[model samples]
Target: MPTDATPRPTIYDVAQRAGVSKSLVSLVLRDAPHVSEARRDAVLAAIDELGYRPSRAASALASQRTRTVGVLIDDFHNPWFVELLAGLRSVLDPAGYTASVADLALETASGRKPVDGFLAQHVDAIVIAADLAPGTLERVGVPIVVAGLRELGARDAGRAVDVVAGDDELGGRLATEHLLRLGHTRVAHLAGHSGPGDARRRGYESAMLAAGLEPITTGGGATTEAAGYSAACALLEAHPHVTGIVAANDVMAVGALAALRERGLSVPADVSVVGHDDSPLAAYRYLALTSVDGHSADVGAAAARALLRRLDSPDAPAHRELLALDLVVRGSTAPPPT
Candidate 1:
C-alpha cells in the first residue's frame, strides 16, 4: 500500500484502474458480499497502488447495513431520469447511503440481467425506476422500492414491493383538463407503451368522457420523441381538426411540435400542446410547453424513505405512495381558434 504521504485517489480513479464500474469498487471495498474473486482482487490492487481511501461518509457506514442502494433506470438517454437521480442522491448522501445508478439499456446490450449486476455487488436495497424485464426481481432477496412510473413487485405470496410514484394517471387527467378548460374539444393523445403510459392514457380517456368528448388515441409505441412525432402525424392524418394534443412525456411532446410545424400549424395558436414529466426540455424558452409536474424530486425522496422503512421492517405492511400532480401552464396552450 502507498504511504500516507502519497496522494489519495478517488473511487473513479480506482474504477478506471480496475476496469470496472464504481459500484463494483464500492462493493469490493466494503467486502459486503458476492463479488467475484478476480474483480475483487483487481480492485484491491488498484486501491493499494493508487493510495485510495474511502470518504468520511463511506467510512461511517461500518455496520450490518451495506449502506448502499442500487438505482435501476430504464434508459440513460432519457433526460427525465436526471432530476429523479438528483432527488435520490439528495436524501441518500445525507443519510450515509451511497446510490449507484445502472440502466436496463446497458444491461440488455451486454446480455446481463438487471438484478444480476446489483446482486453481484450485494446491494442492501434496490430502487426500480424502470420497468424491468419479467423475473428481474422474482427472487431478489433485498428490500425493493419501485420508484417513478412503473408498478412492480413479487408475484409470490408473502412478499410485496414498496412503491412510491407520482400520480401519472392524475397527471394525464390534469393535462387534458387544462386543454379542455381552454376550449379545446378536438383533443388527441400521443400514446406511450409502458406502465406509466397506460395510466396516463386512461386518465385522458376518463377526462374526455366526463367532458362529453371522444378520446382519440395514437402511438402506443416507445416513449421517445420519434414515437411522439410518428403518433402526431397519424393523429393529424386521421383527425385533421385536432385542436389540442396530450403527449406521454416532454420529449414526445417536443416531437409533436415538429410534426405540427411541418403541417403549417403553430403551438398554442393553431393547436395547444401539453406534455408530462415537466422535464427541463419543457421549460425551454423555445418549447415553453404546458406540462404536468410529477414532482419527481419529491417522489425520489419519498422512495428513499420507503426503502429505509422497508429495510428496518422487512415484514411490515406494504407501503404505496402517489404524490399529487399539477399542470404547469405555459406558452404552449391557449383557446382554440374559430
Candidate 2:
C-alpha cells in the first residue's frame, strides 16, 4: 500500500531557487529578450536543479497562445518532406514556435480527419502541405498557410489563407525542355493527381505543343513508385519508341527506372529520365537522376514566415508567393541514342 508522494516542482520553486521574482522567472521561461545574462544563467541553473518542466497547456491558457503550428504532410514515406521540414524548423525554432506534424496517409488509414487532430491539440495555426479533401478546412477556427504550391480545398474554405510555394509548372517545363534540348523527340510524362503534379503535367504538355510535337501522358492518379512503374510499363508497351520520360516526382522516376531495366533498355544510352523535387534519391551515385529543384527548404522557410505574418495580421488580405525552380542535369539524362 506504500505510494510515492513527492510533489512535483513548480515555477514558484524555480523562482525561489533562482532568487528572482516570479515574473522574471516567467520571462526567462518564455525566452524573452532584454533579460541579463547573469539572471538568465541563474534561472536556467535553478530549473536544472529542480528538474522543473513547464506546462504547455497552462502556458497556453495564460497567454492565449500555444505557439505551435500543426503541419500536415502528404506522406511521410516521400523524402521530399525532409528538406521542407528542415526549412520550416530553421525559421520556426528561432521564433519560439514548434511544429507538430501529421501525415495524411496515416490519418486516412486510421479513418480520422487529419485537421481534426490538430484542432484537438488547440494548435495556434495549421500549415497545409497536403492536398486535402473539399471542406476539410471548413469551420476550422485556426489560421492557415498552404505550402508547396497546393491549392486550397474546393470549398474555398481558406480563401484568406496565405500560400508560399515553388513554381512547379516551371519545374515541369524545365525537366521536359532539358530532354528536348538533348535531341529527344519522343517524350512521355508520368503525371500525378495532386495540384503540383497537375501543374507539372501542364508544363510538359505546353512545352511539347510549342515544339510541334504531341505530348504522351500516363499515370492515372497516384504519385507513388508503384504508380510510376505501372505507368511506365504501359507507356513502353504502347509507345515502344519513346526516348525520354518526365516523371512527376523523384520516386516515380525511380519506378520508371525499374520498368526500363525490366524492358532491357539502358538509361541515357537508350533512353533518358527526368524527375521533379530533386529529392535525396536523385543525387544517389547509382541513380544520379536529372531532376527539377523546387528548393523545398526555401519553400518551407518562406511558408513559416508567411504563417507568422498571418498570425500577426489576421485581417490582412491573403498573399500568394511562388519561388522559381531550376533543373539539375545528371547522369540519368543524355542525348537520345542515335
- Top TM-score hit: 2
Native-referenced Cα lDDT, model 1:
0.88
Candidate 1, residues 1-338, lDDT tens digits: the string is: 22234455799999999999999998987887999999999999998898777885445542347688999998987777788888888888898999989998898889966767776666889999998766668767788988976745555223877888999999999999999988999999999988789899999999999999999999998999899999999999999999999999999999999999999998889999999998889899999989999888988989998888898899888888999999999999999988
Backbone clashes in model 2, listed as residue pairs? none
lDDT of 2 by residue, 117-219 (tens): 8876778889899988877888888789899767564236645888889999999899999999999999999999998999999999999999999999999
Q: Rate the local accuracy (lDDT) of all candidates.
A: 0.88, 0.90
Residue 235 deviation, candidate 2, in Å?
Answer: 0.1
Please list the residue runs of candidate 2 whose C-alpha ends up more than 4 Å from where it truly belongs after superposition: 1-63, 151-155
Model 2 lDDT-worst window of ten: 1-10
> What lDDT is reached at residue 159 by model 1?
83
